[model samples]
Target: MDGCTGKIEQEMRAGLRAFFTVPYLLDQGMACLEEKLREALLFGRLTVLHYRAFGGTGAGIYRAAAAVEFMILSLDIIDDLQDKDNQETVWGRLSPDIALNIALGMLTLSQHLLLTADFPHERSGSAARLMNEQVLAAINGQTVDLLNNIESEEEYMEMIRLKSAGLLAAACLTGTLLATGEPLSEVRTYAEELGIAAQMKNDIRDVLNWDNKNDFWNRKKTLPTLYLLQSISDEQRWIADYFAERLQLADVVNRKEEIERIMEESGTLLYSSVRMRTHYYNYLDLVGKISLAPEWKEQILAMAD
Candidate 1:
């Protein structure tokens, strides 16, 4: 997402600064998570940006034809177990173990006050269960996302809701746990809404999703395709079928140009963004309903900075 919702950004930053200021709780949880996952290979672990610890996840996918093809080509199940030199490597390098560890750490840290987590919920839990849920949610979400290509727009949104917002919901629940020790129902609602906003932010980054480098170039089903499917102009629908046939191609540049014209002429990108922002606004309004102190609620609101 290009910018945080100013309100959410303010609110979360304050809550985080306050919550982190407290001794040990956040750190202890994170330590456990790291120790758990570090033994496994972590993908996309570049240093330019630190993981947000929460929000819709974007990196865990084979987004290009080549990337998908690489997996298909590397089908020697024996290769992962027996290293070229050590035969007993016991690691896929991308083992679930590592993601588990990282996710666990995130859940633990999410619990602390972060600035008094009352307004929402999810304040109490056995640390282990919380972490376990985080990893499970991530994996489940990913599974549905992969299945989305074959689903309708409605199903696609559901996948995005799971894969992308599931953890974001966890983030709020964690915050609630640290703040008040309650069931996450209330907090989860807030999270579900915020999840929509977060996804909208992602759509902005995918400005190219409808462009020549469209995410659909890899056959990844996204919001635009669904909307198009729902209200496609004759010209765009004709072009979409053509795009589908080339989903696995090595080159999508030419197709992208054609789609770009269709997207522009049809106003798909703008329409998608408008819809996305509408979700964000709805999420923000949900946050506004929480019962926390004005300042605390405002702090949460400020986070969309």
Candidate 2:
């Protein structure tokens, strides 16, 4: 395994050691994510810093600001060490100083969140101090989404834009800061939008595949269903209507072929595809707008491409 992934695996192990040890999982969702992160680190081939960032933040939620900083450390180390063929490029020259700098910067932001912030959590000071920033970001993202969801086309785009993409954008922004000692807000916005669209495609697979279709069963107000509301033929419409009322996975699965055909023919996939491209271009455009170093810009473009 690569050094970055190795670190992720190690971090995950430590987190799980603490996780399963807890009598009742404090937050199952976060706990489950940590577990998944452990498995992904153990199994996958991710050299990216954000992967490690996701892996490393098992110290509860107060360390998002910290997570951002360490992500930069991981990115800088990866860039310095990995060469053209994705082999080690500059491990020998990569300084401990850089690593230390990354940690200190991350800790600095984490501490900043602690001192002064009206985060979401009313009871848990640490949680409010830590995750409140992310929660606020989420709320802001959701606010924009509520406005956009009025239109069918925009609702899908907006859902994908806010849910997963927001964090991805923040992560990349943090990564860039660690590498270049500078921030790029324009690129940040673009990355955020692209991340959302990519995540939507990910969510779509839940329905597309047989693993889970809870989104439909739950009437999740997701983009796919929203798109389907205005899309598909009467035949497709009736099936979704039935599912909306009945909400049984087997009911849908019994007629999966027919439902899938309707979705495909109704242009839901095509519409989603077009929106995804639009997000990517939006990111690319934002990247171009940034007054960043050419080398750094190249790196940003390369990462996205």
Candidate 3:
């Protein structure tokens, strides 16, 4: 991990330790929660990445980054509960009610941490509001995702901007806000681009797999899937039928290779890759424009690369 990500991770561990030591939490299951915190830390590297990229140079951002990590974990728990996938994960292994309780606890903990971060009062206050706004945007996006009501590529992009990019934008913006007391528009643009590009890569992986995490099995309407579905002939309409619940996975599971071929031949994969790279390039351009020293900027860009 980069220095920013590493320091923020350390702070998160310390915060988790402090929170878990509460008498009431200790009376509950401490071992399981400890394991869950370990898992949660893995997802928090982004917060620190943002903190460092946006000029943060002290331990001040640690509390806020920890809050961001907990907020993300809380949402991840909810997403797993809703999707019922990745059963081997900490949240998935536990009973749904227990998972839900943990999610709620993390959500509140995130808020508390954000309000108490060791930043100026004005900056911390604004950061809290921005965080809440972005989270609500993500919730709205998650709602659309769960409903699977996407109708067009444009609509899908919009939903992803809210669901995936919103939180990322908030993370990056929070770092800048804490460091400079002003959130730069270019930083927000770079954050959104990176978030969108990363999500697209995830979508490609999700479509190619053949498990509970498979987006196709889950009937997700990702850009690649929508393109592939529209490009195929009448016989391949069975793919749509499966998505519509007119067929089962067993009937189509054996056709995985064929699906891969179609995705490749139809240019779906290439199209997705092109789209991802476009945003990636844009992110790089913005990084180049940051008013940091050449070496510092190179380090940040290299980290992303």
Candidate 4:
């Protein structure tokens, strides 16, 4: 995987270069921002993973892979703006209005690249449509997540499937659609399950943090947070109070270690990890069911692990 990661970054760099020519983009340093996105090319890697798994062997898929990367980065910028997080990012460093414009530009560039690229398959339209569908679903998820209206772990899982897993599903599906002319349902299921599992892992990490990005500080009703709240003790009233808005994060931030210890004592983190692993194994099972070569299937499973 590491061997191919460099090649993907190189291809993505070439594809991302196309967006820098826009006058506004040039003026806004969006080119540098695009370069920054190259550091984390996970979405592009997923595209390549599916492409190769489905027997795609051309360089053209790199174009579409880069497009997926651009689309994901666009959403990430918008998410950061919505959540007011990762202030060190290019979008974060710039004003929200300017960042919004850059995000839109990236998104448009992704679609343009996808539509205009000379893919070997002629049904590129199907790929574009699927991308749009998944992105729209992600938007709905992001809206609900931002609103923080989740009531149960079931609801949280549903929301994350849309927000996190949807993008992964789209990335994999884009590759499959561009290569096979039809999106494979098994691939979609595996990608979605993997996405949810990955998001749960992230949620576990998020709850352990004590910063602006801390889920606890933000009052995010994640699986672990909900579990932690379910059985609170007298000393844990602050945790409840904080979630209830009776206490501000500033008052509780310094005591983060104490609360984290309490969360650990309550088995919140372990519960979250077990839940994540359960979804992960489900994804692995679905991957095994995909009708690919044994080696390719092994590679795909190994990549996820």
lDDT of each model, Cα atoms only?
A: 0.44, 0.47, 0.77, 0.81
How does model 1 fare in lDDT?
A: 0.44
Question: What does candidate 2's lDDT look like per residue over 1-305, in tens digits?
Answer: 13544444444334334433444332432333333343333112211332223232222222333333333333333333321122222322335454334334333433343333223343124332323354355446555544433455565555445445654665554433433333356645767766765666665764576533345544445666677777766555665565456555555657767767777888877776676677678777887776665655565566654
Q: Rank the candidates by lDDT, best first.
A: 4, 3, 2, 1
Q: Once model 1 is optimally superposed onto the true structure by TM-score, how far is the C-alpha of residue 130 displaced, in angstroms?
A: 3.5
TM-score per model over all chains: 0.56, 0.56, 0.89, 0.91
Off by over 4 Å in 1: 1-127, 207-214, 246-252
Candidate 2 stretches greater than 4 Å from native: 1-131, 139-160, 175-183, 246-250
Across 123-231, the per-residue lDDT of candidate 4 in tens digits comes to 6678888889888999999999998878788899889888899899899898888778889888889989999899999899998876678898899999999899986
Off by over 4 Å in 4: 1-19, 22-24, 27-40, 120-122
Cα deviation at 42, candidate 1, in Å, is 20
Comparison by lDDT, 2 against 3, better one: 3
Counted clashes in each candidate structure: 30, 4, 0, 0
lDDT of 3 at 168: 77
RMSD of each candidate relative to the true structure = 13.3, 13.5, 2.7, 2.2
Error of 3 at 39 (Å): 7.2
| Candidate 1 lDDT tens digits, 117-192 | 2222222333224534654665566666545454475776676676556555654454344334443476677666
List residue ranges in candidate 3 displaced over 4 A.
Answer: 1-6, 20-57
